[model samples]
Target: MIDDSIRPQLGIIGGLGPLASADFYFKLTRITQAFRDNEHVPAVILSVPQLPDRTEAILAGHDGPLAPLKAAVSTLNALGVACVAMPCNTAHHWYDQLAANSRAEIIHIGDAVVAETRRSLERGRVAVLATQGTLVSGFYQDRMSAAGFELCLPANTEFQACVDSAISLVKAGSIVDAAVETERALDIAQATGADAALLGCTELSVVAASLNDVNGLLVIDSNAALARACLTRLGFGTQEARGLPTVSRPPGHDWPMRGSLAVLA
Candidate 1:
């Protein structure tokens, strides 16, 4: 349960792949502390796990995925959420379409990541480890390029398999399998000259553990960034709430964001 002290209900359009939606919610919980029942932020999550595969639809030019995604956005907007966050990074490819149809402001994961990436690195190529759908959409490349940053990606085959596997494991709730693939994806990124990895897929954030597991490679967790942004917008950052309870958690163990690597891994 979240505290009601914070206002501005958050709406999430999720289940592009269920794992991603879960990841976002888990992070939201971890970002705020609940001293009383109403001290936490309020949120409404429309977890529609039945949406068709977004990557397949985008790559194959199918319409099934788009219809449901649009429906989700409309439903959330109708709920009157202050702002909407889509946990799936790949879904941001439809930024314009979703934003046009929904009244809720779309907090773009890619744009936020790009902004944070630039601030973190002075001049270095940052690689995006995301689903092929996101790659084809060019959301990261386009946004990061606009910010004067180089974008690197995995090979087509590797990228597809990595994303597919991550999705599969996450949907089945197998956090370990998801993490294994995350390490492999990072290894591929290292070989490709990536100075850092964008846990572009929300599920990958499960396996990757706060973007720091890439072995010295800076990781950018979009969900975390969104939480911070949400908090700032909620007026909790004001001096009056300065000492209020904060929602903080160790990386990867939190549910929705679960799937921490075992001691052996």
Candidate 2:
């Protein structure tokens, strides 16, 4: 039993892909430094896997998928949640509209990731691993570039397809194959000389944690960044919420986002 009065509750609009939603929830629990259950942040996760595919809707110029997302936000708002975090990066293409229609403040996961990158890496060439819709939408590229960070992406269509395959595998509950595909994308990022890589897709973030550093290039999980931002907004210090050991690196070394592969709660 958790006490809501002591802390504001968080609403999660998840199920863009069920595994990604579960991954985000697991990361939220693991990252929080809670001695007891009540010490952890209370979250209401509305996982609707049946929600229409965001990328397909965007590519096809259809607004049908946005309806369910809008409804979900409205539901969370009516539940009296202090804020809402949607883990799906591609779905953020409809962020402004969703935020406008919902009463609860919708936290921009990409914005949070950009802020974290600035804080952690200052300004550097960053690589992005995301879906075609996310890349085509330029969500991360526009925001990160506006903040003075150069962005790198899969150079060719083949690499782009590889990234998409990884995301799809994760969605289909194929973690092992998803990891292999994700690693291939990371290799491309490394070859491009990226200072750090952003796992811009929530599904990619699920497998990214299992991968080791690629030639010293830090892999930042956008989901973890969003989780940290949520905790910070809820009055927890970033360091306090992240109880992991810090690595000894050179001055201003890029810090890879921390996450794990655990059963979804």
Candidate 3:
């Protein structure tokens, strides 16, 4: 249990895709090595799915997401959180800006995933599965390459299309189609001779689960990695929290889609 006097508070600048933000919170709570309520990390989540599409802005060379992302960080800072974490992988393209605006430490999902991969494997080809924005940003590619690991990108444009489809399906509340498309993307990554596949997008983490990896491929969940990193950074128990980074929903509440609230309309 953490002492009340110095218990570090966390803020989640979520809703990059909505469910991904909810999923990140669920992972953070579920994986915590807690015996009771006080053992878990205290967090506040600002789930505003109203933010502009990060991928669109990135690919088109627009700075549309910068204002809202920085605003979210400022809000969290005003709320007095000690650290902030955004689950979206592509949004890390604006990480430098977000970090610059925040009074708290903003945890980069890409950095957490890359560091987790380095810890899990000595040196190997890493297949990165992410949004086109993330790929175009070169945040993961540059960092991973500099870390001395070979990278296995999508086999072709079609592979990334499948990933994009999967991410969209999940956001639209189409879980089955999302899983099928996610499986397709994973299958393509597996054949790239890579030792492990990184689910670098938080949307991809929505359907992350145990699979029968015939080739013994290692799969890393970026959202879970970031959640775990948050735990470690906040002085929470993590060493013996959970076994695997399984897809978990925290209890009764369903994660709402982008415009799920009829009352708001």
Whole-model lDDT per candidate: 0.68, 0.78, 0.79
Which residue pairs overlap in candidate 2's backbone? Answer: none
Clashes of each: 6, 0, 0
Runs in model 2 with CA error above 4 Å? Answer: 1-8, 240-265
Q: Give the TM-score of candidate 1.
A: 0.79
lDDT of 2 by residue, 85-180 (tens): 999998899999999998878899988898778767888889898887888778898899999989887465655777889888887877766766
> RMSDs, each prediction?
7.0, 8.1, 8.6
C-alpha TM-score for every candidate = 0.79, 0.86, 0.86
Clashes of 3: 0
What is the C-alpha lDDT profile of model 1 across 1-265, one tens digit per residue? 3344533478887776676666666666666655565666677788877777777877896666677788877777676677888888777777888888877787888766776676578667777767778888888888887888777765546645765786577668777666656666666666677887787878776654523245677777676666656655665441211222222335564323222322212
- Top candidate, metric lDDT: 3
| After superposition, candidate 1 runs with Cα above 4 Å error | 1-8, 33-36, 156-160, 210-213, 238-265
**RMSD after Cα superposition, model 3:** 8.6
- Spell out the clash pairs found in candidate 1: 3-38, 3-39, 3-40, 4-38, 32-247, 33-247
